[model samples]
Target: MEYTVVENSGYDREKDVFSHTSYWEAFSYRARHYTDSEIREMHVEIAIDLPDGTRTYEI
Candidate 1:
C-alpha cells in the first residue's frame, strides 16, 4: 500500500506540502514538526492507494 499525505496551513508563513511513501513516514513527519494545536488548525489529508482504488481522508 502507498500513502500520500498533504498539509495545508492556508497561511503565508507556511506553504502547503505533500509527501508520498509506502509507509507511515509522511504522517510521522507531521508529528515531528507540528504540535497538536497547530495540526488541528491546518487542513490535513491522507490518501491511500489500495488494490481497488484510492481513498482519501481529511482532518
Candidate 2:
C-alpha cells in the first residue's frame, strides 16, 4: 500500500493520513492499540499501486 503524507491543521491540527481502503481500514484498527505519541511519531506512508483509489483520513 502507498499514500501521500501531509500535515493538517483544520481539525485540531492533527497529521493527515492517506492510503488505500484495505490499508486504511487495517491501519485504523491497528492504531487503536497504539499510544498517542507512538502514532504521532510513526510514519505510515509509502509509494505503490493499489486496486481501489487512495483515500484521505484525519488522525
Q: What TM-score should be assigned to candidate 2? A: 0.28
Clashing residue pairs for model 2: none
Candidate number with greatest lDDT: 1
| TM-score (C-alpha) between model 1 and the true structure | 0.52
- Clashing residue pairs in candidate 1, if any? none
lDDT of 2 by residue, 21-40 (tens): 46565456446545567546
Off by over 4 Å in 1: 9-16, 49-55
lDDT of each: 0.60, 0.45
Top candidate on TM-score is 1
User: Alpha carbon lDDT of residue 17, candidate 2?
Assistant: 50
Total clashes, candidate 1? 0
Mind giving the per-residue lDDT tens digits that candidate 1 earns over 1-59?
55655566343554435556544687887777778887777755555656587554532
